[model samples]
Structure formats: C-alpha cells, structure tokens
Target chain A: MQTLEMGVAEITMRLISVIETDEIFQNVMVRGEVSNFKFSGPHAYFSLKEGEYLLNCVMFNATYRHPSGIKDGTVVKASGAIKVYPKRGTYQLYTESILEGKDYGELYKRFEELKIKLKSEGIFDKPKKEIPRFPKKIAVVSSKTSAAFHDVVKTIKKRYPLAGILLFHTSVQGKEASKEIVNALDAADRSSADVILLVRGGGSIEDLWNFNEEIVVKKVYAMKTPVITGVGHEVDTTLVDYVADRRSPTPTGAAEYATPDLIELKRNIDISFSRITNEMDQKIDESFDLVERSKKRLDFLSPKRQISIEKERTNESFSKMIKIVVEMIKEKRSSLLRNFEAISHSKIVRTTELVPERLDSKMEMMKRTVSNDISKKYLSLEKMEMSLNVHDPLEPVRRGYAMVFKDERLVKSVHELKKSDEIKLKLSDGKILSEVVEIEENGK
Target chain B: MENKKVEEMCFEESYNELEETLNAMEKTDVTLEESIKLFKRGVELYKRCKFLIDSASLSVKEVLENLEKEMEIGEDDMGR
Candidate 1:
C-alpha cells in the first residue's frame, strides 16, 4: 500500500472544503448546555456541551437577536452552519438562531404574565414623574463594585460635576438581590436626592432576573423620587425599566439623562445674557433719540430764535426805506436846479430890454434893484440847498448813528421812549429791534 | 417672591429673579430710573448664578460607607 503524504495547509484546506460541501453539516441544529459564553465586540464566542462532547460556536452580530437565557449551564438549541477556522485549524458552528430550553420558556411566560397583569392594573400606564432639568443631587442605586456604577459616576462627573451623587449600594444580582434593591430604593426615596438612578451592567437573563422580580418593580413604581433605570444593554428591557420615570439603555445613558451638560447650559446662559443686553441697548438708544427730538422742538420755539427772525425782517424794511428816501432827494435836487436856471434866464432878458428903452439914471436904478433881488433869491436858494444837505435822512446812519422807531414813528426825543418799550433802531447796514430795559433822563 | 439678597439666593431662585428683572426692564413705559434699578439687580443675580455654577462640586453622602460597615458586620457574624 502506497501512503499519500499531504502538507498541513493542503490537509486543512481539504477538511474545510469537505465541511463546506456536506449537506447535513452545512445546515444543522445542535442542542446542548451553554458554557464559557463571552462577547467580543459585536460577536459572541461560546461552547455548547452535551455530556463529554463539546462544540465551539460563534454568533456574528449577536446583539440583534441574541437569546435571552444564554449563560453557563443554560440549555439551548442553536441553528447554524459548521465552518473550520483556517488560522486556528479548528471547526466551529456559525450560529444564526438560538432557542432557550423549557426552563427559560417558563420564565419568559411568567414575565409576560406579570407584565400583562401590571398593565391591566394601570401601573404601567400611570403618568411618569417629570425629571428635573438641572438636578442638584442624584441618588445612585447599584452594586458597590459593579462596572456600571463606576461608568455612571465617571460619565456624570465628566458631564456635570454640579450634581451631587449619593450611592445606595446593594447586591444587584443574587437570591437576596430583590429585597436589597427594595431596601435601597426606600433609602434613596427618603434621601434629599432630586432624582434616583437604578442601574446595573448588562448580563444574561438569569443573571439579571432580580430586576424582573415583582417586589422590585413595585418598589420602583412606588418611589417618591423620580426613578431612572439603566439595567442592561439596549436590547434588554427589564420589568423595573417599564415602571421607571425614565429608561436609559446603559448606565452612562442614565447619568446623562439625569443631569444637564454644563457646556449646553453655559451656551443657553450666554444666549440669554446677550438677548437681555441687546434689548437694554435698544431701549437706551430709543430714549436718547426721544431726548434729541424734544431738544430740537424746544430750540425752534426759543425766544433767541424769534429775535433773530424779527431782526431779519427789520433789516429788510430799513433797506427799502433808505432806497425810497434817496430817490426823493435826487428828484427834489434836480427840479430845484431846473427852476433856478429858468428864473435867471428870464431876469437877464427882461433887464437887457429895459436898459435899451429907459434913461441912464432910470436904467441904472432898475439894474441895481434887479441885481439886489437876484442876489437875495440866490442867497435863499443856497440856504435851502445847505439845509437839504444837512437834513439828509441816511447821513446820521452812515456816521454810526441809529434812527430809533416806535410803531413806525421816528423817535426824535428821549421823551418819546419809556422803559420796557419794544423799539426798532435802523443802522447803515441792518436793523436792531430791542426792548428798552432802562431809561436815563437828562433834565434840561 | 420675597425680596432676598443675591448672596442668600439659590441658583434657581437667582436665575428666576434675573428673568423677572429682565422682563420688567423690557416694558415700554418703564422709567429710566426704574430700569437702572432693575439692571443693577439683574447684574447681581447674574453674578450670583455664575458664582454658584463656578463653585459647584459633586458631594457624595456618607450613608454608603455606613451601609458597607453594617454589611461587613453581618458577614462576620455569619462566618462565626
């Protein structure tokens, strides 16, 4: 007989191919007692034993539909395909489904019965208490040494250190766990905690069965302090979780739900502060605008403003009066010059004709008389012209003198004016309308 | 609400008072003097709230330690 020698890799490959192609091995259901059950990330690694025979099983993404009672010594029936791991040169069952044994089936039925009974009693439908938005103190009911307790403490400290924590330590799972939980909840309720957190880490159904106890659920329902439950992983919902005021999937989630985050609170405070300050600033600005408008209205009605307006009017009237006076003076002077020239021409003609017709003595006497009358007339005309030059209306105004008027009448004497009389003074360029504040009488 | 000093107020009390002060100041007919008074009070309330938040610390009660001692004594008696 010739013995065929095969390499280790070749033999392993052949074994893998044989298992993968076999119809019975490709799809099989095995029933055994579960042991060494552990989780790695999202996968479950465990061993199923029937007496001395043992089979290794691996469930990928086991969190989706993991059986409730999977633990050491739990009887389960798993359905999966047999596959050889090339790296370890070992075969394992890649499990797809698991069914708990009759014992867990009874437990599940009891859980359902209790749940329905409680629901019918309206305990589950009762209105839950409102959780404080900013809790000052929180009571934590958990195992003294559990990782869930530590996780909750760490998460709360990191998020909101303002909240004080009071631990109500107890045995979270055991024969006496339900009684201890009830006692702890009673103590927490009596404490001055704003909120109570009932928490435990994730475990198998049997491991976490204490939370499903009827006494524990009733105690949670009767708690005066609002209860927040975080008993297991996201897929595990215990009886106590339904009665709690709030339910978080994990211990860290419970802590986060109980206390507000400091960062978010500070952001809200900042928003409120800016809103208040902005409103105040707008009000102050509006007040200032109102004051400014009032000031402007007051200035428009001030006596100083009225005086300036009246002065402008008086200046306009004074300019018009000066123009008319100058025109009248020019016309009188031109007419007087024309009349003098006509009288002188007529006298010269009359005298010359008389000199030719009369005797010498008579002509001489007549010429003397005519010359004397002419001289007299010329002197009177010169006197009148001098008086006109002296009486020029604007002459005094040009020499820095003012013409005072009271009610359109020229003021010629101090007696025409009295104290407290409003009068107008015309100057060369403008006019001043003033009130007499005082009177100085010069006794003549 | 009774008039209390800002120093004597809790965080919620001070915060609520601050909100009230702001509301009063927001009224259109509020006089400048009244607004100024409310603003001062609001500032004090804000300061009190900020102080409370800044000085906060997590304090654990001593009941857990006493409970642990009682449990240890119970286990000792059981062992005996």
Candidate 2:
C-alpha cells in the first residue's frame, strides 16, 4: 500500500461519489424501531435501529408537517438517500419521509378506528343476502396476473363447468387499487352474474390495505347480487370480507361456496328420480288392488255362474222324470204285447179259416186302448217339465231383477220377511247385504 | 284450483307435481271411475317428469366453450 497519495478533499469527494453512484443506498427504505426521537421547530431527527445496528435519520421541515408527533421506540419505515458528511466523514440517511409499520401501533390504531366507524354506520351490520343454490354465472374480480384470480377460475371450472364465468381484471394493491376494485364491483353488480367473488392472495396488511378502504366496503355492502370474498389469508380480515354475503378462507374456497358440487347435484336429482318412481309404483299398486277387489266382488255375484248351477239342478230333475215316463211306456207296451200274443195263440188257425174280419176288429180295439193310455202318461210328464222350467230360479234374476234371501232361505213373497230382518239381495254383478226396515205387501 | 297444463311445466315443477299426484291417488278413497281418472293424470305427470330428466344436460355455449378451450391451452403452455 502507498501512503500520502491523496488529500482530505479528494478522498471525501471520491467517497461521496461512491455513495451517489450506488443504486440501493441512493434511494432506500429502512424499517426499524425508532430511538433518540427529537422534533425541533421545522426539523425532526431520529435514529432507526434493529437489535445492535442503527441508522441516523433526519426529516427536514419541508417533509415534517403532521400533528402526530414521533416518539421514542416507534417502529417506523423511512425512505431516503444515504449521504456522506464531508466534515465528519460519517454516512447518514438524508431526510425524506417516514410511516409507521405493524410494530408502531399507529397503523393498528387506524384499522381499529375504521372498523369502529364502519360498524357504527351499520355498513358491516347489514343482513347478508341468500347465495344462489345453483349459480349459472359467476363474476370474478381480481388481478389478471394474480394467482388468486386463476385459483378461483380453475376451481369453478373444475367443480361446475356449466356456470359461465366473467373475469374483471383490476389492480389489487397500491394507491389506485381501491378505485379499480370499486369500479370492478360496479361492473360486476350490473352484469348478469348470479354471484360475485372478490378475492386476492395472502399479503401483509399494507399489501391488502386497498380492500380495507371505506369505498370498497360500501360498494360491497350495496351490491345487488350476493358477494363472496376470500381476500388475503385466513388470519387476515378486511372490511370487505365483513360486508360480503359470504366469506371464505381462500380464493378457491370462495369459488366452492358459490356453486354446488357436481356430484351432490347428481345425487339430489337421483333422489328426485327415485322419489317419483317409488310414488308411481305405489299408485300403480293401489290401482291394481282396487281392480282386484272389484273383480272379487263381481265374481261373487256373477249371474252367469248362478244360472249354470240352476241349469244343472233342473237337468237332474228332468232326467229323473224322463226315466219314470220311459218305464211306464215300457210296462204298457209289454202288457199290450202279452194280450196280442194270447189272442193270436187262441185263434191262430180258426180266425184265419172262419172269421178273419172279427179277429182283426179285436186286435184293432186292443191297439187303441194301449195307445190312449201311453198318450195320457206322456201328456202328464210334459206338463210337469213345463212347470219346472217356468219356476226356474235364475230366470227372474237374469232380467235385471234381484232375489232376496233371509237366513239362507229364498223369500218368495214380501210376507215371508218381516221388518228389521237382515236380507241379502243378490244382483246380476254384486250382492247387497241389508236390513229390511219396512215392508209393504199387496192388499189381501 | 286452476288446472295447469302438464306440458307447460318445467322439469322441477313437473317433478314435484308428479309426486303430489301420486300421493293423492294413493291416499284418496274414491270410486273406481274417479280412481281411473287419477291414474290417468298421474301417468301424464310421470311421463312429463321423466322426459324432462332424460333430456336434462350440461350445456356451454359456443363463446364460453371457446373460452374454456383457450384457458386449457393457456394452462398447458404455462405447464411447459
């Protein structure tokens, strides 16, 4: 190393040139706890420190105009340039501006104040609207470059492809982000979306401050369509989230809440289908039961079945009468044969030789007596058959007339039955079991 | 009650009506003639409901379908 190469002026100029040439030190932000805080007229001086390291900071009168004073131990985020003092040969942060960070307690106080104001105005206390059970359209408001927007869109498509999605790109952070967000909400409100999703990924309170703006909260509160928000992470709560109809832990969760699961929908439709089918089966079963009951009643009182039974009964009687008539005719014919044989035997030759005319007259007289007796018997049998047929039980009933039976006995006349007697009236198709309350007989 | 023609009902409406009709038919004790009438109406409702369910499907219009395809392509490119 060479000694005595340059003067103090030259060395100071070179060091200052180095400090100005550096990009980060030229304009930088140093966040640390404030100490040695002093505010004189028109000028404020402080030292920012973290643990053992410290940086000397200063804010000139031009940039130091605020009613709130900076005190010791304040955690402040200061932005300024690093400068080398020519006399002291020490570097310091030139005056610019400073704001409080999370540790400073001021930002937290502002958050609480806004929360109180909005709560008092009833903006956060409005009744939530009903989210559509099956949303046909969903509007998503977020930055196009942000993962939050993609998360929601992908989730919605994967879960419910039938829903039409409309994306409104907006700046999610920075000074203008709140206005952009409000405009997006307005557009989404006027559109035909069944639901609107306001979402952004996880970030610090400063990064998410736009969502906490009063304008955005009011817009969310006044939306016609229901709004669901998943701003920031689960632990981070924004005013917009409070005003939304539904809040979720993440962007994808917001999408999930907006539409129904495809499988669940299928199950519901399946349930409806099965319910209808079961009801139809029950109805058909009832109908069949009714038909069967009627059929049984009809079968019990069928006149045709009754008539067949009566015909069989009459046939049995008719056959017996015919057998008796046949037997009588046989007896009469045999007796006539016997008498002819006796007469023929006695006058076989004498009648042929002497008086064929007298023998023939005797035979003719015997034949007429036998034929007259047979005719009389046949006429009586026919009269009995005619009477039986006239009294056939089913004849009257077949002609739309009913037969009344009391205690298993046919009631031939009204006089056979008394008042209050339980009578069974058999009709052509069915039977009526009734009690005869009053009876009017023909005049005697 | 005014009678709404069965053919005019939507799928959800028709399905609900079919269930009601079937229940009424099973619970009431009317004449055979009246039962037959109920049965006829129930059948009509059942047919309408079945037709609607059978024809139900997921439909995405052409513009939206293109949007989906484009999204798929965009996702694929990002994957690569």
Candidate 3:
C-alpha cells in the first residue's frame, strides 16, 4: 500500500462498481419529499429530502410523462438502481419508476404549458377530415387480442355487415407501443379505406399513456385519411384524440362513427321508395280529380248544351212570331169581313137598286108622255090639215074648175081690173106665176 | 316494357327523377291526356326505382382479398 499508486479515475470506477453490486443499493426503494426538480435532455434531475438530509435523484424521460405529475414539494416513493457519478464524485439514485404521495404540481404545470403551446400554435384548430358517410372499407388499428378489437368487430358486423373490415394488429401499451401505433396509422393511411378507426379497451392512466405521446399525435394530425379514435373510458382524453378527425368515447362508438348501418340504409331506401310510390298514387288521384273537375266545367260550357238552350229560345221566339202573325192575319180577316158588312149595310147601297128602278119608270113615263103629246099634236095638225084641205084656196086648182076672177080678190068684180094687173092661176102642183097679159074684166 | 328507357338510367339519378316526376304529375291543371302520359312515365320511374333498390344487396369482403381484386379493377370502377 505504501509503494503502489492508482489514478483518480480508477478509484472512482472501483467505488461505483462496488456500490452498484451492493445488495442494499441494487434495487432500492427510496421514500422522501421531492424538491429542486429540473428536467433537461430527455432526463429529469431532482432531489429527495428527509428533514436535514438530501439525496440527488435522476429519472429518465422514458420513465414518465408530464401527466404523471411529479413535482417539488410532492412526497413520492421511487424505485430504481443506485449508482455513483464518479466523475463528479457523487452518488445518485437512477429512478425507473415513481409513485405519487402528496401532489402532482409539476406534472400539472407541464401539462398546462404544453396545452397552452399547442393551442396557440393552432395544432388543435386545423380543419378536421370529413368522415365518409358511406364507408365501404374500414381499417381498424387495435390490438387483435384486446376487448376493444372484439367490441369493434362485433358492433360493425351487427350494424353493417356489408362493410368490409381490415384489421391492423399493433401493440397498444408499453415502451414501443407509440411507434407501432404510428406505423399502423401509416399503413391504414395508404390503404384503400374510406375510414380508419383507432380504438382500445379501458385501462389505467399509465397503461394508456402511449396515446398521449407527441409522435403519435403528430402522425394522427398529418394523416390524409380520416381517423376516428376511441381510447379508454369517456373521461380519458389524450392528445391524439384532440388531433384526430373524429373522436368517440369507446371502441364501439368508433366503429359506429366509421360506418353506416346496412339495415338502416335499406330501411331508408324502403321508405323513400314507398314515399315516391305513394306520391305517384296521390298524384294520379289528384290528376283524376282535376280531370273530373275540368270535365264538369266543360259540360257546363259545352256548345251542345248552349245550342240546345239556344234552339229552345229560338223555337220559343219562332212560336211567338208565328202566333203574332196568325193573330195579325186573324185581325185582318175580321177587319175585312167587318168592312164588307159595313158596305152591305150602307144607306147608299140600300138605295142603289131602288134608284135604278125609279129611273127606269121615270124614263118610261117621259117616253109615254112625249109620245102621247106628239100624237095629240099630230091629231091637231091633221085636223088643221083637214080643215085646211076643206077650205083650201087652191081647191079650185085641184078640181080644175074654171073660175074667173079679176084682180085676184075676186075676180067677180072684173070692173076693178086694171090694165096691167098680176094674176095667179091656182093649180094642184103649184101656183102659176104669170103677168096679166090683158085686162081680163070680162067675167065681171 | 314501355319503361325500357327508364331502366337504362343510373339508380341514383333514376330515383331522383322518379320523385320529381311524381311532383310534376301532381299539378292540378294537368289535362287528362297529359295526366295519362305522366302516369305512364311515373309507372316507368317507379319500376326503375324498385328495380334499383331491389337489386342493391349487401356484400362483405376480406381486406387482402378485396385489395387484390380491387387492384385488378380499372380506375373507373366505383364499386365502393
């Protein structure tokens, strides 16, 4: 010992190996009050204190998350291997697990910080993908042996048997779970699926921690395919749920969200078909009613009915005209008869026959009177003529008796005859016109 | 037989047309002759819609097998 010398690094290495191999320090469970918590470089550095003594401790990022809520002033029970940091000449506890004792202030603070950051960045505000209303092919990302898988499959089959299911089996818990889930998500994204459902059965907070990972959340946010997620119970919300296109409370709900019920669709079609058919029937009935109404209207406006009515009116007018004409004719005939009777009963007509007879009698009387008068005049003339003949001066001439007279008064006194005296000789035919040739007073 | 033309329409389009036809036929002013024509068309549309609904059936397929079959299908195939 007096002659041999060793380096400082060699001494530190020896001491660390000794403490690491110690039975008491190999797997120690330390119970103390947590303080001076500082997280950096994928690891958390903190101190555990009991009254006046303090021991430094470190927990890796892999061991816990912000939601685990381990912070200063919190009492915790930590279990891990103890080791010495030889370079710094100190020993610390390397914690693999932490159990909550008093409170989770640090975890809460970290959670609030992250939530605020993400909210400000609009990571949760992006437009969500639209879930297809009628999904023919659905891709399910879940553990094959989990009740969530069974629940989804059963529900989908019961609701919509026509929808084809594609299952992508993956780990849903433990350290490698998030990576596996992300890979499954990529696969589902590239698949010819109308929708993707990420679902899991209910579990403890730690058991369901992988869904809260930033990697998983980023992948969910970046996927082109629409994702519907149902993780744990209704209260257990994760970052992926916020980033998902659609979220459901349970695995069965996710399945429901992703597909349309075949029976329901069929029922809808049935309803629509019946509705249209009924409408068609009603329409026909309405058309018939309309046709019947129009027919009635047409009947009312029919030319035949109008013509019949007009014919009746015309016939009535014609009958009235005929009646008037007959009445007029009758009046005229009666008037003519009355005129003939009037003429027959006139005073002049009565007197016309008597007047002709009276005139004839008058004419006959006049002719008789005239004839009688003429005959009387003729008698008188005859008497006169007879008298004249008896006392005719020319009797002598007619008898051819010789009578001598002088100076024509009486030739009995021829003494009065002058020498030159006119004398006449009476003859039956005419008087002799002679001049006295001599004084013939011889007869005196 | 009179509705052979209607049978050629797509089932969605035909179904929509059927509803519209029924609505149009419901007009009160439609003549008897027009009503008769619409009724005939309505009958055709009804037949077309019924055939489409009746013919649509449920079909389920496995993922890999479905994908393989779909790969063989042309891009224009819109079965899904």
Q: Quick one: best TM-score, which candidate?
A: 1
Candidate 1 TM-score to native? 0.43
- Greater TM-score among 1 and 3 belongs to 1
**What is candidate 1's lDDT per residue for A170-289, written digit by digit as tens?**
999989989999999999999999999999998766778999998999999888899999998775789998999999989999999998988998899889867865665565455445
Q: Write the per-residue lDDT of candidate 3 for residues A71-174, one digit (tens) a residue.
A: 78888878788899876899999988887765444544455566677778788887999999988899999999999999999999988887889998899999
Error of 1 at A340 (Å): 42
Tens-place lDDT per residue, model 2, A360-403, is: 78778878877887887788778877887887777777888898
The alpha-carbon lDDT assigned to residue A157 of candidate 3 equals 94
TM-score ranking, high to low: 1, 3, 2
Q: What CAPRI class is candidate 3?
A: incorrect
Q: How accurate is candidate 3 locally (lDDT)?
A: 0.76
**Each candidate's root-mean-square deviation in Å?**
30.7, 36.6, 24.4
Could you say which candidate leads in DockQ?
2
The estimated TM-scores of all candidates read: 0.43, 0.42, 0.42
Candidate 2 chain A, run of 10 with poorest lDDT: A294-303
> What lDDT does candidate 1 reach at residue A62?
94
| Model 1 reproduced share of reference interface contacts | 0.00
